[model samples]
Target: MGEDRRKEIKYHLSEEKIDELLREAKDDRRKERLGFLKNLYYGDSIAEAADREGRSAATGGRWADAWNEGGLEGLMPSFGGGRPPKLDEDEQEQLVEMLREGQPWKSQEIRHLLKQEFDVEYHPDYLGKFLRELGLSYAKPRPKRPWRPENPEEILEERVDDALDEDDQPHNKRKGDDEEGWIVDDDICTDGGTVLGFFDASQPQPYDNSRRVWYVDDPHVERPLVKTEDSAVGFYAVNGTSVVQWKETEEKEQICEVLEAVREQNPGKRILLVLDKHGSHICEYTRKRAHQLGIDLVFLPSGSPHLNPIEQVWKYLKWTMAPIIVENEDEFHELVKDVFDQVTQRVSFAKSWCEKFLDFQKFP
Candidate 1:
């Protein structure tokens, strides 16, 4: 509103600096580049000056023209919309009360409530203005736990002890959210099955799907997907890949056999079998065999798939496999197996990809 205020905010750049920014404006970071120019001349708060210079206030060219014409005052906002203050203090208070209890209520929602309750119709855009006037603009909820123990020593010790007790009691053998012995990953499942990946001392890359998987048969075919109306009922296996019927119910013994196959490939190494806290993965038989084979089974904490490096790689694999278009379980198996084969053949590619990914977001 004041010329001095406008002048104070305007950017005062050297000729060379202005030219550099103008040149940089042509690049992809054009908005930022031109913003710097406008900020220099009008301190960035020159919507009116911008509007006067050009028909549309959104363009940078108009702001430049405003700089070329009248100085900083040209950019300041002017009274353009209309006269203000129709809803007195009482209406504002009512709006706040509605906002607190309303379910997903927008400006239009309030307008409807006004029509239904008090018989008033307001344009959606006007409702936005009303809300803003009431000081109810966008805001993030204050984080509840802004600061937590960086290393909760008790939790860490428990995790470490759990890791060490793989042979004794099996890591996290507790029954999960399976009332009927049914552990289901939240929907969006292509094939009704689950896959497992492992990490060991020899293999620095924690999860490479090509290495080995504890593929199992899943009976829940209702599609474990999160729906807007339905509470997401399955695990969002982050680093892990799609479930598959790579092995059958009759093949539990063979599942251990395949894991042993992986061990045979990587000999004399302390094994770390990383997987979700699933009912099937944690059993007395599986624990006994892992102990016998000198394998250390580890459980990822509940509601944490991001901790698994393999889940991330599996995402990449899924994205790559998306175009293949498999219709059935057999076709899905073939395609997934084909993907596994490709990843298996290119050991360096898998290793490099996992290593680079791990460094990007490291894991324990």
Candidate 2:
């Protein structure tokens, strides 16, 4: 008989009731009713109820005892004061603002600030509890110099890039086992017999073959590229094909001609040309040539360079070539071409092209 009673208790709460409670408890009042209903319908032990409420068995037991002793009146909480606020309203607001701004303030920092400014010294544990109440947590970040000038440009960049590129990863699709396995190339083809080259190493294991892949959990490769150019007048394409063209120079005309050549090279291939929606790249002639070459020109959303493999190549080229001192444009062009030649020789660049096209097929 005792075993039978235990078995009945085990299956007391119907699965439907549990699901109904989960669905219906959208607000505090409904949650309270669900809690009470769970206790009533499930016939859970007073000790179990005590554990659920983080209270003593005596208190939990008393609720049932009260209901038995005086009916519905026993279930209500006595007009007892609720737990005191861990932080005042002002402190919570301040902490939330600081956290929103990516402030790396420690709990001790908050405590110290409170003590110094407001003459309130909260216990360290209590300070953490206060932060938790405000949905804040202690996180150590890179140090910032107190006296450093605030870079509005950096702040705007942060606003635009941080949301999408928080992980500082290069290639999101690359697998964990993928080392320095990919190669990238940047060759600028001009109509007038000119090719400017750019180069970057490739990440390995480009295809994510792992069965346990997750977008949030997976570590991304850190391809060094700026999401946005600092200057207003610059060149960008959907994939890291970015350059600050010398406005009104022969170089700009040459670049435009090279793009035209790219279209000419692949006459019938349904080319998906990804360009950064820069003003120069969006000129009337470029658009006309795109149609003429039968190129499906896709403009990338602003401030998203990670989507482009070419930009990664550009970043790699700049890093590698920064050491070389160029005397003039011709020298720069020669060094760039040499870098391009060196990069195209590697297999990673080909793999990147393959992976990039594959990704596009899936998403687009």
Candidate 3:
């Protein structure tokens, strides 16, 4: 059994009964045991109950056994024998299943559910810890495209395979047994091999914006909004190297230029650029240029920015420069280039995409 796991438990008092006694009971010791019993009755582990009540697990066991053999009278200081738990094994399992269905639960909402569903009530503060002990926590929902295909994962795999465009079996690792493995692109792409890269464009303006900042009564920080935008088209290879090309405007011409730069950077290697289906990217001129340069373009599904890994890189770059003020477009471009170069020189960016879509081998 797991460390958190306990043998079968049985409880004597209903939650209403416990709460009523808790309100009227005069003895602090009786109240403490009642609180412990309340938590234990609502499916908290012995360790959780003991920690919440500031008692030892062994003592909780004794009290629980006392309650099992006795009820409300079992929590009395005189009780000698062991008692039982509030929930039977089957009821506990059913509550777990029910709780999981209506997620992102508020403390009061969950209390209502417990009371209505099982006639139980747990302290609000103790509920969070209790849920964690049972393997649940609050989490933000990821954005999903409502119109996405039913087989998005399958389509994703097919897209990656098409991008590889090699005598490829759908194998993640192409390098032979004797060859050295790389965490980042390193010198492998330069030596002639398929290069997987994420492509994107960004037009960062010279304005300060941040998600959070420490403040006293009120946040009163003023930001400068300079009238200049820095356009950049870029490629970030899974091998740890990135190529950022500064552009005057975001157009098909600049898109082609970035594609050419990627090919020039990874000469002789097949370049598979995963990018979005923007008009500038999907235009005839850009496609012609990419095909001529031996590059394959794989467009991410529309409305799904999270599917492309490079989006994170752009967010990171912006967040890195959020506080600083730049004098001009030149200064902003230089800052963007420096930060992008420093952060993208690692294979960490591609891990999420690799895990979700590919049968990737372990990195050496």
Q: Output the TM-score of candidate 3.
A: 0.57
**Against the true structure, whose lDDT is highest?**
3
Please give the distance, in angstroms, between residue 186's alpha carbon in candidate 2 and its true position after superposition: 29
How well is each residue in 64-125 modelled by candidate 1, as lDDT tens digits? 44444544334222212455444433454565667667644655667778787656677776
Per-prediction TM-score = 0.40, 0.37, 0.57
lDDT (10s digit) by residue, model 3, range 1-364: 1333374567565889889989997877678888988888788887678669876554556556666776667558343445544453346556666777766677788789878988877788887775654455567766567877666666777777655545433222333422332122333242365678899888766565565767788765565556555477889898535799788788898778877678777776766778887898876566656665766677777666677888888888878777666666677788888888887886787887888775454121
Give the candidates in order of TM-score, highest first: 3, 1, 2
lDDT score at residue 163, model 2, on the 0-100 scale: 24
Give the alpha-carbon lDDT of every model. 0.43, 0.43, 0.69
RMSD each, Å: 15.8, 18.0, 11.9
lDDT accuracy of residue 117 in candidate 3: 84
Which digits, one per residue and each the tens of the lDDT, describe model 2 over residues 1-364? 1122222222334757656855865655334433643664567665565446544343344344444454433343332356645444445456466556756776667777777756767787677765654555456775654643455334323332332222333221124433342221123222232111221112211122333324676555333231221111222223223233222233334446555555444333334455555565555545544444433345444554444455655555556554333455444545555664454344453355344333332222
Best by TM-score: 3
Instruction: Assess candidate 1 and give its lDDT.
Output: 0.43
TM-score of 2: 0.37
